[model samples]
Target: MKTDPTYPLFPICAFLGFIISLVPISWHFQAWNAGTCLYMFWVSVACLVQFVDSVVWHGTLNNHAPIWCDIASKIIIGAGVAIPAASLCINRRLYIVTSVKTVSFTVEDRRRAVYIDLAIGAGIPVLVMILHTVVQGHRYDILEDVGCIPVIYNTIPAYPLVFMWPVVIGCVSFVYAGLTLRAFLQRRASINDVLSATTTLNVNRYFRLMLLAFIEMTCTVPLSAYSIYINTSGVTLAPWISWSDTHFDFGRIDKIPSVIWRSDHAFYVSVEMGRWIYPTCAFVFFGLFGFASEARKHYRMVWMFLAPRISLVRLNPRCVQFRIIGTMP
Candidate 1:
């Protein structure tokens, strides 16, 4: 019927997504992952739009923030919600053609695509958020400092916990990335033969998702592993005011550090370095690849395998064609 209830759910979804983005931001001013940062940037603009929309037309902030927010806002809310929202917006034309043009696809197939997007886009993020919330809430007294605040939870303790966050993030990201990539590839293969520039562009759109997933996982995994290594073995003597040193003594209380020296776990620095290196690569690669991919496909010359872009890249090509049901020639 009416384009799968997006208008009704858009407001709820947008606020939740914004809240999710704020979580990492609360973790103290470290840079957000590439995807999240972009999403957040859009969200800020979206929030402003909502504010303007309400003030200009007597709309309330509570109702406005999410409702007026962009589609990227929907996707960030969670994979379950985001995926369907993306699908509805992404494949609206396809669904319309299927209905009016008498395309061979069953309504069930259309629904399935919607379901898959929801599953991948919303499901993955929700799962990770849950896991992180439950198992990774470490204990660290928030302190005012110039550098970023360290999260020190049992799941992220120096010895055993350090490895937890990175590993969890890495594993979740790895699985999601792999599945998303496979799906993108499959979609690309299916649509590659369609000569219509529109079809090609639609399919190629999926490539961006694959690239995004790949960038997130690849960038974060090694960092996680390195974090685990540093947390486990790299125990450095704390400064005079370190929480550990203040609360518990490791028998070196009297020796104040005139100079800092590496302990047995100094090699852990290398692991931390590796983590940074990999994600830096991912960050750089994602930026370059996205720019290039969009440029190459700008005229709708290539077959796309993923959903279309909302910003930065545009694939709204007119070549997207539709054939009536059973009318494939």
Candidate 2:
């Protein structure tokens, strides 16, 4: 099946997601919204991975920049997988869990927690990619699969390394969020009391934040499943298309080493479909839904700043004409 017709949409989605993520990132004041910044950081990374994928996949440069193309392809793919999940994990552990359970919070505590989150969020991906590379035989060649370079897939380590941990973390978060939501909803803690009422409001607020994390998990988990399915399925998946040079309608696909990670036509195309689309969904969801109220505030402020400038620019042309006439006189 000629899937190339749909290829154009992925890049467009990637670019759009990248642009949307900037809104929350810009609004983030770390002191007030530290967890949000942590979450948004990974969301931005995922979007960035897609944006780069859009560029190199459809363009002519992927194969030529082997080191960059190969290393970046793996790292970003890992980033795409690990970062958002790690962000959610961190947000749940530090913010939601801590708040509801009355967990202690000290200056060093937050610092240590954030450092851990950043390290895990960023580190795991790199480590996974490297391990994947080693296990896969370190193939640095142009992975001219589908329209773009495919990430590490179909490896033994991928399940535990790439997919399992995130799944576990997301599950833990969802359960805690559910429990926390129950506490707020049931009002068993005596809603008539002012202190309890305030606690409900606080828990409700934290639960909403957790919901945002859940939304991210909803977007990402399916992508991972789809990848695992297509790769591991017994059915003959796209036997018609080759992941090799024969499938290449254009460009010089050089022979490079093969890694432990492998790809087939079905899996490659399947991956392309999900890669940008998931992150795009994630970025848009968080950008619009997660930050809806905040976004409106920011949007109003931006309009206030830009409206006068726009009016001035509109008025400038006439002023320029008048000034020209006056100078001539």
Report the number of the highest-lDDT candidate.
2
What TM-score, to 2 decimals, does candidate 2 have? Answer: 0.66
* Model 1 Cα lDDT, one tens digit per residue, 277-327: 322333343353334544445423433434233222334455554444455
Q: Which stretches of candidate 1 lie over 4 Å from their true place?
A: 1-148, 151-163, 184-187, 192-205, 234-286, 289-329
TM-score against native, each model: 0.35, 0.66
> For model 2, what is the C-alpha lDDT against the true structure?
0.51
Estimate the lDDT of model 1. Answer: 0.35
Give candidate 1's error at residue 251 in angstroms.
22
lDDT of candidate 2 over 162-232, digit per residue (tens): 55655665565556555555664565454234233232224334445556666666655565566567656
Task: Assess each prediction's global lDDT (C-alpha) against the native.
Answer: 0.35, 0.51
